[model samples]
Target: MQSDSKILAKINQTVDRLSDPESYDLVCHEHRLGEPLPSTEKLAKIVNMIREILFPGYFGTTSLRPNTIKHYMGVYVDELFELLSEQIMAGLCFTCKNPHEVDMQERNRHAQMLASEFIAYLPEIRRKLVADVDTAFVGDPAAQSQSEVIFCYPAIRAISNYRIANQLLKLEVPLIPRIISEMAHSETGIDIHPKAEIGESFTIDHGTGVVIGSTCIIGNNVKLYQGVTLGAKSFPLDEDGNPIKGVPRHPIVEDGVIIYAQATILGRVTVGANSVVGGNVWVTNNVPPNSKIVQFKARETSFSDGAGI
Candidate 1:
């Protein structure tokens, strides 16, 4: 055991190191007085509340039936509005250059308006989620029912979160949308950027190690397998050598396209409608519509063929 004096000295030194201005200058979050930063934990609860609202019996409180559903929805909607408004305001204040320069009341009203707009879109969001659930059921032979897809599928969990976060991003709510998507990403091992625009009737099979980049526009009825990467080919450097931001870096996957496991489709290319890209293929160019791309046959090797080269 260390001596008490040694422990105090060590703690003091650690605190001094942590508090050094140079150490924290770039990464520390700065907020104004009386302004609340977005809370990841609270945002997580909000995501859960959304799932509960959308799925009803499958997600939370299965005791609810047809007769009592309306009352439960009303209560959940009220609670969601309150929670979402606060978090949205927190996100706005967090991203503000100087919170004091803005009028607090108008900002609060704006947050309320955005929150109401999001609430209005919830039914549509739920409708799309039903399509996703049905897709998952049809895509996976192991799925016993649509209820099984909702109850047992991690893809549904991740995709539902992406949809919610995408709508939040569309609403111009800032940091909170990324955080909400990341909450699902951490749990599901599916890294879908909240800014990615994925359409209806999408499903992923065994959805581990899937990465969808921001600016990716996925069309309807698309299915992707595990270990797929829809990523940028390379960054276009600016005059200062920093990569230019928001220049449409990812792929535009058209309707009914299927990218298989470990396939790498990069850049702002288009995987044309109804196309299928085979597993382990590296695609960096546009694929024509209705094409099926697969790997070439492996050549047989012999000692006389100089295969070592």
Candidate 2:
């Protein structure tokens, strides 16, 4: 071990290096003294609360009888306002370049108002989730019941989180929505961007390695199997040679389309309505409506070994 004097000197030097503006400026998020940053832990709890409120009967241990449901909903909504408002305000602060310049009281009021608006959207979210659950139940032969789809399916979990995060993104609340989607991505291997516009009755079977890009627009009654990637082929660069943001890049899956397992569709191409895209095919063009796309059949080969080699 080193002497105490050397240890003290090393500690002081490290502290000085960390505190230096040049050394820490690029990596550190310089937050204001009183402004709170978004917490993944709190957001996780908020998601659980939303799940409890959305599907009261299935998720937790609580009973949702006729007499107790109103009481539970009332209590959950009241508590959600407090927690969600804090997170929204934190998102606002995180996105702001000058947090100290913002009027915290006014921002708090705005956050609360937005939180209430989001609470009102719960019914609509539930309606969408119901359609998704039904689709998953019917699409997969292994799914025994709607309850099984709701509770055990990773697609439901991922889609539910995506819908919630998409609403927040529409409300123009930053940072928190992406964080929420990332929570789902971590729990299930389905990576859906918060900004992606996905329509009703969507189902993903065996949802692993699915990447739905930022600018993707998926229509109603669309189904995607495992390892399906809806991504950007390439990005248009700016004057600085950096990729431009918010350009339409990913494929649009029109209504009634079924993209099978391991299908990779790229660019702003539209996969037309009622089409069937087969497994493991790479597509970068617009597919006509009611069309079927599949990979070419492999040639049959025979091996001659019978101990005569």
Q: 77-163, model 2: which lDDT tens digit per residue?
A: 899899999999999998998666789999999999999999999999999999999999998889899999988999898998999
Which RMSD values do the candidates have, in order?
A: 1.7, 2.7
Task: Give the TM-score (vs. native) of candidate 1.
Answer: 0.96
Segments in model 2 whose C-alpha atoms lie over 4 Å from true places: 302-309
Count of backbone clashes for each model? 0, 0
- Please provide TM-scores, in order, for all candidate models, with all chains considered together: 0.96, 0.94
Worst 10 residues of 2 by lDDT: 300-309
As a whole number from 0 to 100, the lDDT of residue 180 in candidate 1 is 86
- What TM-score would you give candidate 2 relative to the actual structure? 0.94
